[model samples]
Target: MMNALESSSTRPYLIRALYEWCTDNALTPYIAVLVDDTVQVPREYVQNGEIVLNISFDATSGLKLGNEFVEFKARFGGVPRDIMVPMDRVLAIYARENGQGMAFPMPVPAASDEQDDAAASPDESQTAEAPAGEPAARGGMQLVPTDEADAEEPTDPPPPPPRKRPALKRIK
Candidate 1:
């Protein structure tokens, strides 16, 4: 007999395995979800208390890549509905690679720091200019020629253009 904690730990894996099996058999596995109520305002969404088959892409910009939250369209009871879920929140991962395949459990979430470090110290390169003793640093700044020192100066503008072209004549 397994303890309650052990059973709980295995539950997600079992669900994933079933989903994969459905995919292998070319059967769509739907998930009945209790969506976060906060997201319902924009779309007038409804959970409808049934697992609906999700048909959407898994492209780079789509839901399957990883860590991306996505909104996809699905039809329930002949009415179109919008469903949003985070990839992390996915309970099952299934693919129809083989007819009647296998499902794998969703992985556990890892701990992460969500806070931004606005007060972190700046990098040395950003705060200070390198010393001139280094050869590389010496060539970094360009020298500008001053008008008072450099003597190759243009004194006058060229003559004005001709008002008209010479008339064409018959050649011998």
Candidate 2:
């Protein structure tokens, strides 16, 4: 049997499931993506190194949510643009209406990380880029818990409720 680290990534599958969930409930599904040279989208639409895409049936054409990528055609400012975002670049997929969905941890590899990897011995490279004791990585992607304590049961009390909502409120 394949070990957990040897298995494929679950990010793309989760994105597909969330997209279906949003559409089934009449909500707009939007994906927050981290822009990089590998991502293919209208550069003008990207803001602060990220871009949010609407992947609803009405918004995108030829949408293909594959294991490796999310390919589709979306319109930006009346111009139909082709979008191809790598699965790893997707940060979150949430319903625009209720803001309910999954938020994945963005894998921010250091600029010089790859160089160091290549220099390491073959066996050393097989281990996870994440710190020790965490889950091992599969290829270049690693799915780790948001908090180290998440791996075990919570012993502390829940966080206090927020004092107020976000500063920029939507009146509409």
Candidate 3:
């Protein structure tokens, strides 16, 4: 029994979960990511490794992985560009961080169901797909600096490339 607001809030999380499920099942879920109201790009862009600015877009645009930092690419004033920021990057998302942030609970497979699926085919056991999507599960928090920090003085210039061996003249 969830209220309309609660249901609405959960949409993004559901979308994310579906995307994960699709990926686990070897399916590609098409996603349209919009940054800053003006620019939009496909989710493949993020998958391809590009930094992008954060901006609010239609909820139907796609699953928003909130509370996490993501780097993506977008256009600024009709020019191609790239940007990076935490999930908390967008001003709108920050405002909705409390309860409006999306969430999707992981689907639990029943033990009997699992057994049935396993009995159905031997190969299925060999290919138990990961439950989550990209950004694999991590055991512990690791601090990673996004920008340069604690600059160190250069100890020495980079070693130059090895010179080619001189050709030897044939003896007469």
Best candidate (score: lDDT): 2
Q: Write model 2 residue lDDT over 1-172, tens digit each, in one string.
A: 9999999999999999999999999999998888988899999978767788888999999999999999999888899999999999998898888888888877767758766765776567665364455445633655445767556766897999979732211112
Could you tell me every candidate's TM-score relative to the true structure?
0.29, 0.66, 0.24
Top candidate, metric TM-score: 2
- The residue-by-residue lDDT of candidate 1 on 1-172, one tens digit each, is 9878665444345445565566556655444233443232124433331132343332112323223443555555557556565433443333333223223343332323111211243353234454454333322333446786566666886789979833211111
Q: What would you estimate as the lDDT of candidate 3? A: 0.40
Candidate 1 residue 110 Cα shift, in angstroms, is 21
Span of 10 residues, lowest total lDDT, candidate 2: 163-172
Clashes of each: 14, 0, 6
Stretches of candidate 1 off by over 4 Å are: 1-3, 6-8, 37-43, 47-172
For candidate 3, write residues 92-161 as lDDT tens digits: 2211222222222323346786678668885855444434543332222234465465466678988999
Score residue 126 of candidate 3 by CA lDDT.
Answer: 44
Candidate 3, after superposition: displacement of residue 157 in Å?
83
Q: Give the local distance difference test score of model 1.
A: 0.40
Q: Model 3: how far is 67 from its true place, Å? A: 6.6
The regions of model 2 sitting more than 4 angstroms off are 110-113, 116-172
